[model samples]
Target: MDTTGWLATQRDDGETVGYLEPLSGDYSLVQARNLLGHPVGGPTEFLEAEELLIDRGISELAERWSLRDAPEELDGGVVILEASPDGIVVAHADLAKAGVYGRRVHVPWPDVDLLLSRETPAARET
Candidate 1:
């Protein structure tokens, strides 16, 4: 029997790639690549990396934003703390009331660029 609850797909650079396939338990790292749209590595390598991300509670959808860890919402605005070859780390809180926790999630460079393009006031530097 198929225990499919949800399916999540996304276009990273441009190609439509599979992100989450609950029925097959696949978090596809093969879908995440440089702008050129080439597979990052062999299928086995991609699978291993995908597994590690999921084990850390970073769902396939979350991985697009490079969320390698479980999210913890905080009380503040979105701030880009760091950027590296791997990804950009963003500290952001939900738009809830004050006195709440913020979330620190790692987003890949591509996604980071996309977010920065939005240019929200809260994300502005002080």
Candidate 2:
């Protein structure tokens, strides 16, 4: 149930958000709920997003940095991030962005590598 992974992502600035989650296995966007400390629903790239967080430590990274609320488009990814040594503040939303008022998943840097969305982010960027 508990494990670790990684998501090597390049920010809009071309910076790296590496080493994020500690949850192992590739989960769907719904499984992202596990790493994100939240729940996810349909049409969301849960597994894809989860893997990236696991690999990049994007969730634990958020614990160390102050992040801006990237546009709440509710796409299938982490939209906002502020940099830190541990990782980066990864802001993710479901496809519909349909959780709460914010609908954002905050993954602490250390645990991001464990997320399920790793490959999706890679394919997206490439």
Candidate 3:
């Protein structure tokens, strides 16, 4: 997302947890995705939006996600390696094999179809 004018919200430790986007009369809470941005809540009071991000934003990143309408090799399962304003770098779940062969791709953030995975990394560990 374009956050050229958004106000950044930071944790006590000075880590930016999210951003407060200025709207007409309210602010939108956009969670920080490894320096990238993702809207999670919006159009609320500025303080509320900031509080929401501080409380929930960081934990959200731990959740696993999958891609839709992407190449078959990047579809089944993947993990976000890094995210920037330009795009996100994702690697296939079969990292032990595929990643070894440099199976990573950069896709536009807005164009990516990010879906919450039914199975999380923790679930896969078990």
Evaluate all candidate structures by whole-model CA lDDT and list the values in order.
0.37, 0.39, 0.59
Index of the highest-TM-score prediction: 3
Residue pairs in collision within model 3: none
Residue 96 lDDT, candidate 1, scale 0-100: 20
Candidate number with greatest lDDT? 3
The residue ranges of model 3 lying beyond 4 angstroms of the native Cα positions read: 25-36, 96-101, 110-126
Local accuracy of candidate 3 as per-residue lDDT tens digits, 1-126: 455667778888887776666664334433333234656554676677777777864664444556655577766566667655567676776662444524777767543244333346665566
lDDT by residue (15-106, candidate 1, tens digit) is: 33333323234543233232211233344344553443344332222222223333445223444455433465665534323434255566
- Consecutive 10-residue window with the lowest summed lDDT within model 2: 61-70
> What TM-score does structure 3 among the candidates reach?
0.67
Model 2 deviation from the true structure expressed as Cα RMSD, one decimal place: 13.6
Rank ordering of all candidates by TM-score, starting from the highest:
3, 1, 2
Query: lDDT score of model 1?
Result: 0.37
Query: Backbone clashes in each candidate structure, one number apiece?
Result: 6, 59, 0
